[model samples]
Target: MGLVTIAGMAESGDIPMREPLAYFLTWTTYGTWLPGDQRGWVEKPGRFREPNRNMEVANREQMTEPEFVLTSPQRALVELTIRDHCKFRQWSMHAVNCRTNHVHVVVTATGYSPDDVMKQFKSWCTRRLKEHASKPEAPARGPTKNPANSLPLTLRQKFWTRGGSKRIIFDQEGMENAITYTLDGQ
Candidate 1:
């Protein structure tokens, strides 16, 4: 009998859903992409030719304010939070970048679903953001429900959309390509 050890290999029990060698995940904040975006848009199962005006209007109406944009400091906070979370989980983080509208991260975490990882990152980041914005010295940027309130107006708003792109990297080449895209393409 022979025993073998494989690098970056996940045990069978670790992954409940489809087991990917690694994951390249990306998600955007709510109201960032409207129905008739010049870059095109996706809603539901099928794709539409023209932007869904009704959908765009509904999305905007649901927002408490205008589109959600992350400030430089806020982006930094999110990126740091993600790095810290990955470190604590002992996951191999290839690359990560947080922009005003969206965030991208490439990581290898066996025994965990991509959705689980995304949720963890989003939840932790949101909590940290709320905490940071609630501080007494934090600068005020957006419209507030109550001027006396402790939390920032943006913090009270939705930070991310429902679902996002989660791609699986199955091989060394795929991992390298994903990492390059995350670090440079973003």
Candidate 2:
């Protein structure tokens, strides 16, 4: 059924007329933030799972390499990747900030889930990071982050955590908040 808005409702017959105004996506680099983080953690469906110290320890034990922290070049590459991809896809990017441990993005992309958006960002970023890592002149700017980890950046298995925070913003206010948070809150 086609959605009509005359009744001050956004759906009709359980079908939405359009997607949310924007998507607020946040994700961390691999191994940096464990499952049982003291700041809280999301399991699925945006619900917070109970914190468990044992779970955190178990997560740490499963690591094959040190946590991935974005170097200055890496961070810049990531943001550029996102911008390029978004431009190619004709998606609207409200804001994007890539930090050492995590990254935040606010965007409006039709016909795609927030999960897909995050995956695209992570995948492209990984590809770019690998390419950058292989360059002999690529400066290892953040050399102190994981100095003891034996694996070279180029050979690392993954660059990001499996899943991330994806919030659907339904209104203009929420979209503004997301953009502000992505641009300035980090």
Candidate 3:
């Protein structure tokens, strides 16, 4: 019923700009490194602080210039992936970008939850990617990866890491901020 914005990152954050890496799906998450009681949105760790917490913001304008721009190939693959999946699912894209470490997409789905949309998108995209890829055969050693995660997983486990965080986009101002944040950095 409302617009959705989703973001995903490369596997273990190890994607390089030059190579086409396998598709891995992720939903929004607050930093998992926070304290146990601060795990989800109810805690909002980015804005919250403990008794002895300290914050830091370095001045980058006077520091060394940024060395890399997110590459064209990497950006294009992400863009195409989002577009293809959205089109396949009848979603409308308001804005999106495939940045170096993550991807952001804003869309409206007619008849689906954002979680359902993400699952289908990940399945189709991962299958298509494997179809077009050239990967080495499984190693002739013990205990191969289970084709997803190697660790023992629940049989009914899903692909995405967790439920995505969402905000209600009520007007033009929210839309503008969403677009700007997706295109540029935080």
Tens digit of lDDT per residue, candidate 1, span 6-113? Answer: 333222224324347687788887668866665667553233446766766776787664566677788899999999999999998889989889998988898887
Runs off by more than 4 Å, candidate 1: 1-19, 44-50, 140-157
Model 2 bad stretches (over 4 Å)? 1-17, 141-150
**Candidate 2: residue 22 lDDT (0-100):** 70
Per-model TM-score versus the true fold: 0.77, 0.84, 0.46
- The better candidate by TM-score, 1 or 2, is 2
Candidate 3 local lDDT, residue 58: 30
lDDT of each: 0.71, 0.76, 0.41
> What tens-digit string does per-residue lDDT give for candidate 2 at 8-76?
222212334556777778899988888887676877643578778898999989987778877777789
Q: Quote the positional error of residue 173 for candidate 3 in Å.
A: 1.9
- lDDT for 157 in candidate 3 is 25
lDDT of 3 by residue, 23-114 (tens): 22234311222222232222231234443222211322322222222234434654777788778766777777665433566566655544
> Lowest-lDDT window of 10 residues in candidate 3?
54-63
Of 2 and 3, the candidate ranking higher by lDDT: 2
Question: What value does the lDDT take at residue 167 in candidate 3?
Answer: 42
Superposed Cα deviation of residue 121, candidate 3 (Å): 2.9
In candidate 2, which residue pairs clash?
none
